[model samples]
Target: MPNDHHNAPQTGLSYYGLSLLSYLRESHPDLADDADFIRTRAQAAAEAYSCIIRSGGSRIEAAEEADTVLYRGLHFSLYGTLANVIRSEFADIIPEEDAREAALILLPQAREVARSYELADDFAATPQYALLYTELTGTVQILLDNGIQ
Candidate 1:
């Protein structure tokens, strides 16, 4: 929520949909793989967050409509695969489950973010793509430090 730098969704209240939703604002019917990733991650994150909430934890979906979408995409414009993006960027912040959660939160948005820019020598070398790739790393660190769990 609001990226308080202290209150990330640890078990149930993450703004997963909002993060991915921003990257997918555009349409590209030809890119089936990227589209699938975006769709799948968004749906899974939604369900996971919902499950956490239903079990009695508080939910913070309200932030989903605000800053989480528009302001964050400037960071992850890289071209690497989703796993590499997370591995490189979120090296220390994410644990096993957190990594899983982040993937669920990021896969789709990552695809769109990647597509927003063109790539070369593989998705990892493109400048614009690399920028966004590194941005996600920073975001993950922020989230982890704040307590995303």
Candidate 2:
């Protein structure tokens, strides 16, 4: 009986949820490490701070807050994964710390550039959006090349 270990509840955490929780844990280590805290309080802090049921802000404001949370969280996760991959890929030539530091520096700027992209007047055109998209891609390309070189 003491050695049996088959009754544990499974928590099939999704990629997005895990990323959100990872960010919350990194930003607020003092918070309790539990599903209840993460789902209600920590999640609200990361994903609902601007749209609390009693906050009384406009719907647009709440939507913006949600967008901010989702975008930033995705960016954080993207950087984290990229750094890990770069470090592993260039293990012989690049130190893990250096690769991670480079990623940390570039990710925010890349995210800003990405968010700046917007559609042009024509339905099929996205000149400004394409420019920003290329800029972000070039930034990442530089990071990847330099990371390996």
Runs with alpha carbons beyond 4 Å of true place in candidate 2: 1-40, 43-76, 88-93, 112-138, 143-149
In candidate 1, the residue pairs with backbone N, CA or C atoms under 3 Å apart (3 or more residues apart, or in different chains) clash, namely 38-108, 75-132, 76-132, 77-129, 77-132, 78-129, 78-130, 79-123, 80-123
Cα-based lDDT for every prediction: 0.47, 0.49
Off by over 4 Å in 1: 1-80, 96-101, 107-125
Candidate 2 per-residue lDDT over residues 8-126, each given as its tens digit: 21154444345545654443222214555445433544457445434987767775675465434233343544455456555665577687665556656555654654322231243
How well does each candidate superpose onto the true structure, as a TM-score?
A: 0.32, 0.31
Model 2: what TM-score?
Answer: 0.31
Per-residue alpha-carbon lDDT of model 1 for 37-57, expressed as tens digits?
545555666665566566666
State which candidate has the highest TM-score. 1
Candidate 2 — worst ten consecutive residues by lDDT sum?
Answer: 3-12
